[model samples]
Target chain A: MSAPVVDLPAYEQARRIRDGELTAVGLLQATLKRTEAVEGQQPSSRPYALDAADLEKVHAFINRTEARALQRAEAIDAALAAGEPTGPLAGVPLAVKDNFCVQGTATTAGSKILENFISPYAATAVERLEQAGAVVVGKVNLDEFTFGSSNESSAFLPPVGNPWNPAHVPGGSSGGSTAAVAAGEASLSLGSDTAGSIRQPAAFCGVVGMKPTYGRVSRYGLIAFASSLDCVGPVARNITDTALMMNVIAGPDRRDATAANLAVPDYLAQLDSDLEGMRIGLSPDYFWLKIFDPTTGVLEEQPISPEIEKAVLEAAELLAGRGATIVEDVPMPNTHMGIPVYFVISRVEAASNLHRYDGVKYGFRYGEDTGDLTELYRKSRGAGFGLQPKLRILMGMYVSAEQYEKGYYERALQARTLIRQDFERAFDPEGQYGLDCLLTATTPTTAFKIGAVYGDSVLMQYADMLTVAANHAGVPGISIPAGLDRGGLPIGIQLLGPDFSESRLLQIGRAYERATEDASWRSIRPIVVRNLP
Target chain B: MTKLSGLQSFMQGSGQKDPASKKTESCFDRRTASRYNDCPEGEEVLLPQYPSRQDDEITPEIFDHLVDLAAFHLEPEEREYLRKELNAQLKAIRELEALDVSPEVPITSHGVPFKAAISAPLREDVIEACPEADDIVAGAPETELRYIVVPDIPHEELE
Candidate 1:
């Protein structure tokens, strides 16, 4: 058989193969070979894909769906061959991040904490994609409990390395999903975003990822992390793929209390909308807050990259050229407290939500503690949680301390109210600074060398700084490939919309994406650094 | 004066060092002290409330008093919100303050409820295989018996 189809989008390859231009067995073989070559190249590290016997088992499972997938593919091919019709992602093979519970598959969320855990039911989002006939390859990796911004927090698995620059981190806790899509291992992967888990990796790996409005999609089976901030979204090779996936997965679930009780819009159906009359706000103050205090009119030391600033300015112009009213003089309130506020709120929720991992009812349990039960709990937690998770737990616990209540927890809550109010006032039609969507740079800087996050606190801090406000405000933020930096690493232009206004955000992104012809920004990727043990 | 271990006495006697010792001490009498040791302090204790100033210090014992004070003075909505905030903060402290639970009872940590519904469908009896097993296994550092293996855990640790 021709080697498994390697290095192509699953949908594209599947369609071509089904039309007699490619073969499924050949594609599987090539993918296996590529995975093997990648493994051999890094003899010291874990492999990126499963093995020969596992492949056989996988094939045996695929064999059950292979007939149906092939029939559907053939039908699509027949339609295409006869000048009939097909869906955009018809016959594509994709995978959902393990945070999503696919029927019968263990949804581990990348922690040994729940390695043996299986979902008796499929998540509503996964079910939607399955209904659309996307063949799920397998659950990808992630941070434990989707807790860390980097994939390293995973309790059971190694960090998901960026495919191009294996040494640099693939942004996480959706790092594996981003890596899988970027490395051509999967065409589309669904990952949860809380505090930029999806967008950060998308920027790092040079892929397209979207964090839809909170409650836009159901969280029925998503293992909770900061419930109010978590959102299930798509990561794909490009914006179109992201939009296509969004169309399938965006909706409400009766079981999810927080899910928005609104009708799901056809995301792809409106992809071609023009931004001619739309107003896109370029918040110079919001973008430059790290440097300047516009209210005080003083320059500061937040040292932003000249490279990124230039690209963002150009992105605004590009949108303006596409018939959009680009307003650059608009100012939003300072978001200086966003990161701190996000940490407190997220930790508080995390502290409360994560109390379930106690080895009593589920997952890993330690019986080694013959000591007092309290010590057993502390030791179990100290042993079970990774550094990041522990840090958050500690931070949350500290803030929630009785004496510290008003000083920290309530203060953080009040700060969140102020941030939300700022967003509301900015987007208010009758307010002083009314605007449609607020645009800002996704990252202060481009992808650095992998492992750099361990050293540079500011770099790591600013990584999610741009995305956290939306999480705090409970609004939608979309990150589009803006323009590349001097080093050719991709830069993302982030657009924030009023709550429940994801449709407008996507429209604005699509318009600008169409206007920009910077193909190089899309082509260049991260520098790979491989580590094998 | 009830008989107690050194640690218990150290904890109980430590509170007498505070200024409100007389008011706090009498309440910690034999019957109350026994129940208070394991009981959550926020829900169980009562004391003279701290002043309504936002920045006032809140001890574990003072929290219950604060709640009562809030109930007496604030509007219903205001009291409810403050109660939630206070209770949440107290619960976090209590988790830390709680002496280790016994080995038979695991210290519950993660708040995620990972339960499958009783009415949930059963897994198909026929084994379903992985389509990307080769791709997945390609990344495993070590493998044996078709499973991605790792350094063996010391069997005795059991957690």
Candidate 2:
């Protein structure tokens, strides 16, 4: 059966809208309605009466800007009626992760500290998307301060469940962004990755998430987590749509000094490029053997699950069959250092960035509860910040502290440099193992049950094990749905490219999508979409 | 002095000493008495139940110090949980120390730095009105005519 209008891919929806087959307003209304159906409202008269089962299926958004969305859609329609040239993404309904400020919307960042904070200005990336005529349906949820790998850390909202199975988590801290796209609530989403926030969740939710090379997309107005590693990128159902979304938001911005001054390329132009003559690297060391089990707190020399390994190997073989050379067992010696390096660096930056919410200005405040200024500072943060953020802050403070800086923080940074050099060695055309891109399982496993890793802080932290290397190396990474596990949960294969190799990454991802289309692998929609309320 | 000890001394020195009583009182609360049992005139006054850490392990005392350093007012249970979490993180971070990274490898504190050849255009330093100035203060819990009002500092603490 054909999918519902709301469930169509973003590019298809945009195409239909442009061809007069669909109106931007109709698409927005359908998307908003689907969103409301999935994220059912709590009964205001008796908020406590909401059923646990109902709450489990709900909560992909922190706040919905329906009025603004409809207004934007109407404007798009009016412009189309006037025969004015609309931008590439005209009439597409998208979701912005709450961390990205959207003017006139409550951008809580899934934290109580910013629960009531309305952004006075929108993020530059969001502005670019809106200017391209994409109607933002709402601000989606995320881990509070974007700290946790699971959505459980969000203090102000319900946990975002996986669309594949409501009982499972939609990997995080961009869980809601991925879940929204997977559940057909939003055609596309903008998610930030500071150590795999975008890719991990996309892997879990069976959607495409791209973390562009660091500074490739402007980080202006994006709530800073780890300034050096953070990137704003797109999450959608397919690579073409992701490429299209990237085209609009990838340019440099003067507002963000870190944004690369390099010219943005036309991503869609190379979407159909074949994998012929390309060399794809497969690292047996990291991807297959030496999996770290956070639950047991042990790093073992066992292979990954059969299904995940098969899917990754098949992806490599598929490319090989298409004339690309599959370079096997390219040793990434320092691959094990990704988690530790990311942990130290991210925590340090998170501690620094989160200091802005001291209750002295726009966010939550506790001055009224205390007569002392220091007490106000402490209490406001104590009451407003969640446990996960507090943990990260403490870790950050501890590492960056005088005693531990050399052994932990500085060493981690140096270790990060080594990790980047590892990738550089693999990507160097003149080196022994020159590669176009490296392929691996986006996550070690498919979406785990919700709360599975929530209680285990180590397990939660290790969820970014496979994806953090890209962020640490400041290269681009993309997660595309490869196949399904035994339980029918979607599995994703990741492709990591050298810095500014987004066009090549998209080209390979699109080629894989085409190769798998005949097997219905690329078309596997989450059960949530089929059973949308 | 070691940075941690230096910070500890700074924080210890900044404590509000009761001038008349010649005792160091609790810096966080005036209602509470001195945190130290035997008060010395000039020696460092440490909290009796300060969460202590050994080497890399983030002990309860060290965790508490970290909380204060980060200005996070965590509850007792939350503090305990974080104490454990921080220790685990520190343990995990030890993996990085195990790696054979040469001292010559420059630290990548920031992701790959911008190209040295490409000079970034500088914006002129000119004062301009903030369009969101009113909206910025709108979310404050308490506000005066046009400014966010924070709690008043204690006179003795200020001095």
Candidate 3:
């Protein structure tokens, strides 16, 4: 039908290869060819203007690990030829978010600071994926150190474009992770979600992305942004593949003391697509948007786009038809405070984590002779980090400063408590609403054109307000494509559940996916792939 | 930097150009500084001072102190843009002040209630010698025989 090799889902690809119907190497070839066809020139450090020819195509990868991928693919093909047992993901190509350390690839977190820095050890997620027989195709682009809501903040220029239409942004800092999957360059991706990094981009790129419960996945090798808010998760073309990815990546690791010790659930096994008795919530707090008026320095109340609200309402109807109980007007009063709390909490943690990037380490350092260590530190960081990371460091220092900690830092943490409490109350089983999950629109609006809201950090952060609550509450949320808007841009709906509820989220997501499979928009392909032979 | 009359008590030693200087030209190149979004060196911006009850909206003086403490030598344009955004975000973060959180609300470092029961058990602290010492050192920007090299650490004589 649509190119037998690359068009199939991750599980299908693995099955085809594992069953000897397709060679792993042959599938790898098709994947590489598709990547070459769709992915334009790899993005470069900002201020280094891209060629005009490079602007229209999807710039998904920051660096491709073709050599290593070929080796893994060949090994799998050999393992299959010898009649040996193969892993469930025997031939699935994986695009890792640049923040995750992959041994052979230069894992720049879409920043120039780590342009040449290669990790000697891979992240536990990457390690587990490879052990489960997934091939690492390359490192994808992201917001530098996962700082911004859009990929535009990446020091690497020509920010990751939405696969649906490259002129638009593929919401970020895991923009490239979702873009690759949507463009069919990779069947699966490992994207870290800190404050909606994975879910927002996946929603923008029209792919399935999930943020597992905090500590559900090991953060041992992820380049830290806001550690408490960050969750390493999966990005894929379908719910099943997302589940397949979660099965491998979601587990405890001794290296990360914060990793949950509970047994990892087989996410694939839980995707029964049965929504019977599930209580899905609808909060009025989420339907409204808090628009930050830069001119007035105040957050103004506004309704989200009519199209997005309709999508959420329609999704509630569809799930209701599938036997899920719909709970409306759930009062999540503190939901509106997600971004405000995130600003203080994420910044302080970002500031603390970024302290390790001194010049003497593996990453970029000032090249010139320095008079002292302080001078070295200033010049290296000033030169190495982009505006956003520097901005974060400055904010972190200011808020956490001795004089300001009580008012800003500690106060934000307490506010975060209220946001968490909102979820706790809703999911408390014995509480009033007792929502098994909250169903809402993934983003306030559909993917916007590149450069639309990049410079205004406050405006950009608001794009994540609908999704940031899950990050704040350390709950798991999944974003799945609902339908296309009048602009032909994809609309995404999200489902958020309490701790260790990834399986149920995936199950609900799979049910929605099955329901939408026969829709007319489902037949549409990304413009980048529509004309390709 | 114009020294705030009361700021010298805690904020000092930020090598700022005097605000009263008759020289109109900035130490930073105007043309290059203007390329960034806002806040060229000499251009002054003032906003309402509001720690609400405590007079702590980030002023130029406080911004300078934060820049120095963060060990960042920002371009004049960057300084302007960052300071503007920082204050703007601080305004948004003021949403926290309106919250009715009392002193008794325990803070959560993470969303999941990470009781020790669910946390990874600590592994035995056995000294397994690292075999990749050479490999780890190879990543340093400057290195000497098995040691990471750096510029001299400067110190001043004690008074």
Candidate 4:
């Protein structure tokens, strides 16, 4: 009778609403119904439990904004009825990661410190999305302070399970955002990336995630993990949806000093553009033949998982076949140093940023056990913070200490300069190695079993090794579903370009997606969504 | 072995053994004795418990000092866990020290210096009341009427 509720791409749903072929109320109801059906249910288990008990099992949403969402949907419908102009993403239902502030909603960022913290103001990105007529459904879970790679680091909420296999993890700290999209709970979602938080989770949940060039989106209200590395971006089912979100949220904001003032390109317009003569760089040192061992803390020099290597090679070949040249061995010698550099900078900044939450101004306070002002400060933070955040704070303190500042913190900053130069060298047309974009695997492996990498912090940190370099260089990178592993987990390949080259990256990505549309590997709908009634 | 006897024997052995021999024997004996104390005589010790106290840059004492410096109050177990975790991270950070970075290389605090980009102009600062100031203050745990209530500061500590 009406358009099928589940699995409808964001663009199509928006179009139907825009055309008045489907009412916003009907779309909202259908999306909510579908979300209720599949949000918390384990897809692998038989006999679908449509009961209220099962709904409670869904850990994806930290706070569901049903009333607000319905109200917003009604307003959009009313606007269209009055013959008013609507933005491109009108009537689209989207999820916001809990890290981004949404006024009147609890924005915990998955930490107990902010467990009851209500955002008094919305992030610039959230405000823009809502202004573009997208309805905010809920806030999703993430790692506490976005410190750990796994969503298990969430102290206040249950770890978000991968929709692909409930036994495995939805990669984090943007796990719930990606999981919400993959499970069809939300048509599209917003996530902040500070070293692979967005792309890794999107890869795990089998969705498209883009970390725009640093400063591309305003950080006005997005919770900071690493101020230098953090970039707010979108997670969606397809490139078009991601681009639509970019259209609304990208460009400089007067509120955020770091927001780039570059002209916002129409990402959708460049989707159908030709890729002829586009040079894609491949770094053998960074991408080829390496498997990280959690047990020994070693990144072994062995052939990468055949599936991942095959996916990258095939994508390169596909681009080359479509008139783009594949350039080999672009040197990024300092790429491996990104992890340590990022660790130093991010932790130091986090230590400084988190100092604001010391019980007096806002968020959690622990004055009960206070013997002095300092005790109150200590107890408040110590009691409020989770394991990973505590550890990181200590690490930040160690590196930034006056004694170790020059050797650890200062040297890391210097190394960051070298890393930035490496990317510049690759992108410079007049320089030795000129390239349009670089290609690499998003994760070393597919979504791992939950608790597999949980206990090992080093192993968890290594999850961002492939993705963090882009953040360090402040470049734009997108993770597109390349294929699936034998276990049917999604494998993603990332395309990295110089600063403000998001349009070019999206163009190359769209070309690859189109070429592989008929292929079995294009997009994988998680079993949870596929099994929905 | 009985707990008291184990302690007694360990103390007596340390006193009786020559200092030179004790150095070598303590390495093996302390590990063996600690392992043996945890298990029955016949039970195999899968892995010996090596004392974490070694010639390391980050020791428990230094870790506590750092925790104090950071103004974090970790519980005993949290401190021990972080002592190990921080050491591991520090080991990884030490690798950066090995890099041949010249002192002349400019430090990059932010990824892209948007201030340098002509298009990204700085906003003019203006004095204005925050609309949500009350809402933000309301979110705090302790507030007196309209103001946030904080612990009284000892004036000497401030100095």
Give me the displacement of residue B45 in model 2, in angstroms: 42
Local distance difference test, candidate 1: 0.57
Off by over 4 Å in 2: A41-51, A55-58, A289-299, B1-56, B117-119, B155-159
Residue-by-residue lDDT tens digits, candidate 4, A39-130: 66322211121233432344688788999999999999999999998777888889999899999998888887887799999999999999
Off by more than 4 A, model 1: A1-88, A291-301, A367-379, A455-459, A523-533, B1-159
How is the predicted docking of candidate 1 categorized under the CAPRI scheme?
incorrect
- Models 1 onward score TM values of 0.67, 0.89, 0.91, 0.88
In candidate 4, residue B31 scores what lDDT? 28
Question: What's the ranking of the predictions by TM-score, best on top?
Answer: 3, 2, 4, 1
Clashing pairs in 4: none
> Where in model 3 is the C-alpha error above 4 Å?
A50-52, A291-299, B1-56
* Model 3 lDDT tens row, A1-533: 65646878999999888778988888889999999998877678746443455547888888888988999999999998998877889989999999999875688888878887878788999999999999999988888898877687787766777777786788888898888998889999999888898888888888898999999999888999988888999999899998888888888898998899999878888686588999999998888765443335455676666777898998898888888999999988888789888888899999999989888868888998878999999998888898889888888888888888999889888888888999999999999998989999888777775644555566567778888988989999999998887767788999999999989999888888877778898888877888887
Which residue pairs in candidate 2 have backbone atoms (N, alpha carbon, C) closer than 3 angstroms, thus clashing? B50-B61, B51-B60, B51-B61, B51-B62, B52-B61
Residue B101 of model 4: what lDDT? 81
- By lDDT, the better pick of 1 and 3 is 3
lDDT of 3 at B145: 85
Each prediction's Cα lDDT score? 0.57, 0.78, 0.80, 0.76
